[model samples]
Target: MWIVLLLPIVAYIFIQIAFCRVKSQSKYLRNVPGKRPFLIFGNLLDFLPGSIVFLDNLMGYLKTYGDTILFHDGSFSWILLSIDYEFNEFLYSSSVHIEKSDQYQFFHGWFGQGLLTSSGSTWRNHRKVITHSFHFSILLQFIDVFDSVGDNLVKKLESEAGKDSVEISQLISLYALDVICEAAMGVKIQALEAGNSEYVKSIKEMCNIVVDRVFSFISPRLYKLTWTYYREKTALKVRGFVLA
Candidate 1:
């Protein structure tokens, strides 16, 4: 009688283990009508960060599943609804439940409860503020600022060209940094001239760290804590240096 009782317990344990295994494997398994994602990376490994593999992945899925492809991006499931003419018309015509996903909350730790990351009433208020700030008249007034910055960038690029080839990425990043600093904060960065400015260095480091966090398989809460500390420390240093 003891043996019989032990057998049922053992069977239940085995079944539970099997179920757990299935659940873990289910994210990579292709149930939807599209090309199967990679076993481990799930169509993201090649496409992440600097690479343009996302286009190829989308094309592959389009060939197999038409316009709309349903796939799991790691643990997060997404519906890749194409921007075809018919789909665009359908989307615009509907007054439906169009809200940002829960996954977007992951960015809140990095961007704070800011407009881009926040939701509901907070986002609504942010939108109102931004709309007022970016009125047509305001944008028109900024046109001369844009033209002056553009001329400076072209002149700088012309000056930096070597006999061989230049590091295009670094140069473009500096140009963009300069433009953003001037446009947003009304402060000149001169990142190309100083190359290793504290603010530019910190921003580049922070960007790399954020990208690393985005691709990590760790829990979002833990990642948020780690990134928040790094971001705050780096930001304080940058702010101090900039003010000084």
Candidate 2:
């Protein structure tokens, strides 16, 4: 039993070492210079728990590797192209070559095939419809709608400020939600007024949960199988409330 367990463990270690060596060797073959990626985990382990550290690590890599760097996340490889005039021009010059990556399929559950997530001809058609709907004259007609929402937000904040130094971040978020609901759906959520309004609470909780799931190593398919009571139930309720 001891021999059997030890043999498997040893073999696993050997395989991991070999994979690391092969990945490291590939750096030499490539035209650019980059830090050799670690085996299996790659550079992901360095920033596994949070994005702040991940961003810091990426900045450090940028300092060392210059603007353009190649890195691997799990089995997925990507090129980090820092912003430059030439790169911006190349990106905006053509819609044909600037298609969404295959990795975006993972977000299907969150956004469905909506305009933000859709691509190719479907995206083009959606863009045309939205553009026509928001023509200059149409937008100009909504000036009162915009002004009313802004005034409501300023009044709400003035009332809240009398109590104590408000948590500006939370207040701003609630204000934004109220504004969007009134502007887009023609529904007043009044999230800023109620403070603990169910819709506002649910939206914030859902956003936090989604962010947590995205940063984790959990399989994207697993999110499809599992539904949190907070997100699913609240989403259904909110949708009904909004549509009503």
Total clashing pairs for each candidate: 0, 0
What is the alpha-carbon RMSD of candidate 1 to the true structure? 6.9
* Winner by lDDT: 2
The segments of candidate 2 whose C-alpha lies over 4 angstroms from its true place after superposition are 1-36, 49-71, 75-93, 160-166, 225-237
| Candidate 1 per-residue C-alpha lDDT over 73-180 given as tens digits, one digit per residue, 9 for 90 to 100 | 543344355646887688645435335654665555445676766666776778768978876777776677678767876777888776477777887788777777
Which candidate achieves the best TM-score against the true structure?
2
Q: How much lDDT does candidate 2 score?
A: 0.66
Residue-by-residue lDDT tens digits, candidate 2, 1-244: 9999899999888678867765675666486546666756656665564466877887888898877665655443433445457866877566676466545554454457756677888878887789777668867766777787678778877887777577889878877787778777888877877888877776766665654553454566565566653465455465567657
Residue 121 of model 1: what lDDT?
Answer: 77
List lDDT for all candidates, in order: 0.64, 0.66
TM-score for each predicted model, relative to the true structure: 0.63, 0.67
Candidate 2 clash total?
Answer: 0
lDDT (Cα) of model 1:
0.64
* TM-score of model 1 vs. true structure: 0.63
Error of 1 at 126 (Å): 1.0
